[model samples]
Target: MRLEHDLAVRREARDIIADDVAIGVGDGWQHLVGRALVTIRDVTDGKVNARQIKERQGLLSIFTDIMIRGSETIAQRVFDVTNGAADQSAWVCEMCGCGGRLIAGNRLRVRCQVCEADEPERERVWREHRDDILEAAATYIRVCLEHSRLFPVYNIVIRVCLDDRDHRLFLDEVHDRLVWWRAGSWIEGVEDALRQDFRRLDFAR
Candidate 1:
């Protein structure tokens, strides 16, 4: 993030966050966090309290956890905003906050080099294999993938558990992305042939 843009974000955050959040790491994720803070302030009618403390910069996106101080309804709204912030990071560069895409592999990463000039050698070991589905429910599915030490940058585990309507909406977004990544980008139709048992999970139904 440029100095000017970074300063601008701080000003924006200062206005909305006001005296509620004392400390935050609003770096690299200025816009996403800024938007969430604005929403949090607006929806809660300035009754919410929150502060971002960490940034989980993943291969596909960035994530952050906030210390939220509010009622249950306010807490739920914070979660929604946080998730939205992370999801929006999928296409935004973790370095410069520009448009970017995932660079998957044994060491999954993203294409921030397009803007920031830092490109690592691509090593794709995402292959046709199956791991035990440790748990699967109507709203979420989990399969063991490479551990964090091995694939530190990639989001090896994705658990999308939401309400029925939100679940479908979220899965629909994942489906569309898979059509591009699983079908077009990475393993051709192999995700379909390989993870065939995935349908049995019945997360959508």
Candidate 2:
């Protein structure tokens, strides 16, 4: 979340928010969170304890452990209010605070039509196990470099590894990073720089 939004919510709901409570969601849900916290405070009569507020799998996840002095009915009310807020966030864009839906991509995210339209294409394979694929690619590059020379030969080997799915995912991520940063080729070092970062590859046989 933006610092201003976070601080605003904290200020508005200071009566309910405990010192250690964490708010770790995006800006789009700021209104929802703020409103919910206020409602919770009102319903619980300023006797609630919030543990955490974060995003999980493109949805809001709020944890508020009610105080011991709180009544069972009030606790249930807090649960209902917080859960309702979380449910509401499912349709709220995490970026621009517009109506959004869960989008399937390299990562699951709630994005409005405009933001979704602006996103780059990502394959289903990239969505599932993307981190693992990138790790495998890194290990492969490290391994290839260790087994082979570092000049034109390493480049040829890395290019050939592109025929494998994992390596291609890594390349796709590299391209995506380039686009994200609006980087020109020379500003970011060449592919060799990427290869040089890898020290070794493990062949699990």
Candidate 3:
């Protein structure tokens, strides 16, 4: 996606302010202005981590009732930064294979109007197509990983358990590989138990 015009303008303003601060345009305000400029720059450049950017942007104040608000606050920021140019349409319907006329009305739900014409059939098809469900799950997981910028180790773990139950041995092997590469630890045994339980299920076979 192209950078938003408003964001570009704000970044330019930040740079100008930073330059002024460097040349002693405002002695006492230098530090505050400089830090603010840096924060803006980092956020615009996608360099600031989510937590840091959230704190800097004061997102907490704008969002109370975290459970209820969902990602609306962040979505609005993204929209604003992109000058309302982000395509908010659902790329594909999880329920049906239909592509167009999918409305993103709620955070959790994406409904395709054409598919809604026969809800029973859509649900039946979705339930019957195990491979399609697995493919969708894998695609969703991949998109999430990419958006979150997750580590390769986590990606491997997620990939191995994408459409299946967690496996301890599988997870342990992933961890071992990471360790061999001198990566950080981030394993949870509960995931392995879940995998084992899933593996034993007849339906999963």
Candidate 4:
């Protein structure tokens, strides 16, 4: 699938992504949430099933959240999946089949650190993920995001892979939020911000 930086291009590209997306519609892009989102869906039921538990019932703000921070490779893959129909992402950069990062600039996109670094940074965008590694490393999956009408919009669902870190979630530099996250909606603004980030991909632009 083609991922573009131009808002018009992205607008047209949705038709292509929607062709593959099972649900279609921007909000209907549930399949893109990936395994992480799936885990969240399974756990919270996205309120579709029933309210069982939450990290908090309120909100907590993290100074920073570069989608799985400290790990550029995973971030790039997430970008590829969301922006490019990169089904084969497999926790690896879908472009070079190596590792990379998600660049948030004029447009949300991903590229290899080795090859695409020289590319001009056009269109205000956001990009992260540095450190260099040779071979593929272990996967570091983060919270699964859900598309819900709930004010928070993006409901985070974390899955424990044998290590669910013992049903706990550790953040980048924000270690304190971890406690607030598992407690319940730590605060509404937090989710609202997250949803805003997720919403970046939902428009014609």
Alpha carbon lDDT at 131, candidate 3: 45
lDDT: worst 10-residue window of model 3: 52-61
Model 1 misplacement above 4 A: 15-28, 57-68, 103-110, 119-205
**lDDT (CA) per prediction:** 0.41, 0.61, 0.30, 0.27
Task: Judging by lDDT against the true structure, name the best candidate.
Answer: 2
Model 2 misplacement above 4 A: 67-69, 117-205
Clash number for each model? 0, 2, 2, 27
User: What's the TM-score of every candidate structure?
Assistant: 0.42, 0.54, 0.22, 0.20
TM-score of 2: 0.54
Clashes of 2: 2
Clashing pairs in 2: 142-201, 143-201
Give the TM-score (vs. native) of candidate 3.
0.22
In candidate 1, residue 29 scores what lDDT? 56
Which clashing pairs does model 3 show?
A: 165-195, 166-195
Q: What tens-digit string does per-residue lDDT give for candidate 1 at 1-205?
A: 2223333444565544432232233234567766776776677676654543234455322222334446676667767876777677667765557776655654433346543343321111111111111111111212322111111111332534334433333333333233233112333323434333432222111
- Give the range where candidate 2 is weakest over 10 consecutive residues by summed lDDT: 178-187
Q: Give all candidate RMSDs, comma-separated.
A: 17.1, 14.4, 18.0, 19.7
Ranking by TM-score: 2, 1, 3, 4
